[model samples]
Target: MTTFPVEQIRADFPILQEKIRNKPLVYLDNAASCQKPQAVIDSIVHTYSHEYANIHRGVHTLSVKATDRFEGAREKVRAFINAASTKEIIFVRGATEAINLVAQSFGKSQLQAGDEIVISAMEHHANIVPWQMLCQQIGTVLKVVPINQQGELLFDEYLNLLTDKTKLVAITHMSNALGTINPVKQIVEAAHSKNIPVLLDGAQAIPHMAVDVQDLDCDFYVFSGHKLYGPSGTGVLYGKQALLEAMPPYQGGGDMIRKVTFTETEYAGLPHKFEAGTPAIAEIIGLGAAIDYLNQFGMAAISAYEAELLAYATEQAQQIKGLNIIGQAAEKGGILSFTLDRIHPHDIGTMLDSLGIAIRAGHHCAMPVMDFYGVPATARASFAMYNTRQEIDVLMQGIKSLIEVFG
Candidate 1:
């Protein structure tokens, strides 16, 4: 196993050195948003400083240069997912918008009354609500695949849920709240067996592990840039070429049309048909820089190091009195969620903040998972590649103090 240079990597993120409440900050809210490295930050600055202009509609020198960088970022997203072509990658605002794009464009055109869409119990609201809205409008129904107590999706039950009426299956590659990594490959294979297209919510999965859209053979995959240590307002939606070509334009506006007249208009090709209005040029370039940074360390090495940290944190956290850990699946990412007996998660989070340890406290945007577990909310500490085992020690100490003070 290759040893990760965690300390060296930490130096690249200036925010990690920040102090909170007179102490060094131990940021454990990675599942919410990862800290951006200097490389990504610089890329944004460089684009605005030297490469600033509107892309794809001008002949000026600045516009040509800016267009190259913007389109180059598209290629970066393309290679990152091993997509067949750049035409398959559509830029959206974030995972939320990406899901909406599929729901409104593809779902509206293909689905009819009494049709079915399958989603899991652990889906983020971004994956759930859009489909619900679409279903409500078209008189369709959503079939939910239940999970076990361990937060693992019941594979057999998922297979049984599929039928000819099922138009699509959407699932999260990793649970943002539980840290459970679902068997996405098998899920896609089963959905394909039924000739039902599958969409994987890659918002949580792409940051922690390697993703190959072609390898999984998923029809659509979406993720946000900020969660991957890039800028906000930028995301990628990877759709199969045939599907993208078949689906109608999402939101019609400028640049999506080839020729416009008073009576007739011709839409542009696959990706441009989906991407309308002025896009996020600088943020997309920053995302490209983030991808370049990830390639340097490789996802395999980062996953291995994070696994070591997760084990250490879990073992130490289990020793805390009156603390109940949630979502103990056989396979997990870097997230750890737990609640204390007779203590609210918000209170625990506030106390941890005084000690400069940041963790998320809430339902984590997955109310269904919380409802299933019978908990209102939980305190979550999710790790990343730059995080260290020493930080886990600090987290344990903080939790131990929370228990003592509450008593």
Candidate 2:
């Protein structure tokens, strides 16, 4: 195995050199959104500065150039996730919008009243709320598979939830709050056995690991670009070609239509059918640049390095007095969620920020997970490829100082 060039990787991100509170920035909130590499930032600047135009609607030179880069980004996303084709990739605002699109379009078309949609208790609000809205609209039932104390999904319970009534299975590939990496392949296989389609919320998983939608055989997969070290307001929804072809268009406007008339309007096919209106042209190009940047190190390298970082962080965190580390699943990603005795998470986060240690302090948009763990919020230090062992040391130092003050 090649040695991970962590310091070299850190150098590529311009924000790593930033100062917060007169101290070097230790960015550990990567699960919320990653710091962009210089390459991605340059790509955005180049696109808007040199070739800014609406794509797919104009025959002008700039428009053509913009369209090529935009569509090229879709192909990059396809290859990044090992998707079958570019046609299967639909650009959305983010994972939230993508989930809503599927819920509204596919849920309305294929499912009926009383049909069940199975999701895990550990899903983000993006994964939960959209389906709840769908259930309210169509009178469908939302069945949640439970998780154990360690934050691992009860596998038998998940399989039991898959029955004749279950129309769809939407679950997170990795928990944003818990750092739990669910057995997605097994989950997909169980759902597929019942001929049920599966959708994976890959917002947390995509940055740390390589994802092959075909290998997992999931009907749908969604991830946000910002979490993957790309620009905000850009994401991808990868669905099976046959399934996408079957579902109606998620939105209606502009390039999504083949032909329109006062009396008759026909929608486009496959990917274009779902991507409507003026998309984030510059951001999409930047996303492609982000993919190219990540390709240099490969996902395996990133995953391995982050795993090591997480292990180190966990070991140090366990030594902290009266600090209870949450989510001790057998398999986890890079998140470290915990609660300190006699101190609120917000206080912990605020104290850490004074030391230039950045972390997320809230329910993490996974209130259900918080409810399961019976905490109002958690202090989450999520790692990424650019993070170093030194940063973790800084984080631990901050935590220890905070505890000493509180104690």
Candidate 3:
């Protein structure tokens, strides 16, 4: 494994240097969103200060420079995920918009009534709600594959759910709530055997590990930029070139059109067909910079270091009395979720904040996962590339102090 350089990584993010409530901030809410590095911030600032212009279809110097950066970002996204081509990468608001684009453009157009879409029990609501909306609109069926008590997806059961009528298999690459990394390559292979295309919600997985969409053989992959240390309201949708070409544009306007007339209009090809109107220009450029920053450390080093941090946190968290860890999957990322006896998760979050220890305490937009675990909510401490074991120790101290206060 390559040297992680955690301290140097921490230094890249300016926010990590601050003291919250007189104590150093121990940010453990990375699964929600990561703090931006100086590089990403500088990229955004530079774009706005010097190269601010609407992209594509302008010949002015600023427009040309801006367009180059915008298109260059698209190539960066393609390389980041090892996508086939820049044509396969579409810019959207975030993963939510990306999934909806697939559901509305692809799902609605191709799938007929009674066609089934297979998803897992551990999916984020973004994955679930779009399909539900599609079902309501088109009379399709949504089949959920169950998970074991450990929050791992039941592969055999998932296979059984796929049949002649199953149109697509849409699932998460990693669970934001539980941190369980699904067997995506296997999932894709199984879905492919039945000629079913698979879409993996990669918002949680992209930050914690390296993902190659080509290797996984997933038909479509979506993730939020903010989750990967980029700006909010910017994300990516990577689809197989053939699939993207076949699907109609999700929205109609602006850059998405090839030619528009009074009566007949032709849409743009590939990615531009889906990206309607003006996009978040500065944010997208910042995303490119964020990817550049991650590449500096190498994702393999970051993943290895985060794994060590997760294991250490899990061990320390399990030792605490009255704390019950949730989602103990064998294959997990750097997220630790747990419930404390006699203490509401909200209270834990509130108390932790007082000590400059930040953690998430809620359904994490995966309320179904919470219902499965028989808990209303869980306190989650998610690690990032910049986090240290010492931060985990501070979190441990906060939890112990909370438990004593409740008693």
Candidate 1: clashing pairs of residues:
none
Misplaced by over 4 Å in model 1 are: none
lDDT string for model 1 (1-407, tens) is 24798988999999999999999999999999999999999999999999899999899999999889989989989998999999999999999999999999999999998999999999999999999999989988999999999899999999999998999999999999999999999999999998999999999989899899999999999999999999999999999999999999999899899999989989999789998899998999899999999999988888889998999999998888888889899899999999999999999999999999999999999999999999999999999998998899999999998888889
In model 2, where do residues sit more than 4 Å from their true spots? none
lDDT of 2 by residue, 240-316 (tens): 99999999888889999999999988998878999889999999899999999999989988999889999999999
Instruction: Encode model 3's per-residue lDDT on 64-88: one tens digit a residue.
Output: 9999999999999999999989999
Clashes of each: 0, 0, 0
TM-score of each: 0.99, 0.99, 0.99
What lDDT does each candidate get? Answer: 0.93, 0.94, 0.94
Alpha carbon lDDT at 364, candidate 1? 96
lDDT of 2: 0.94
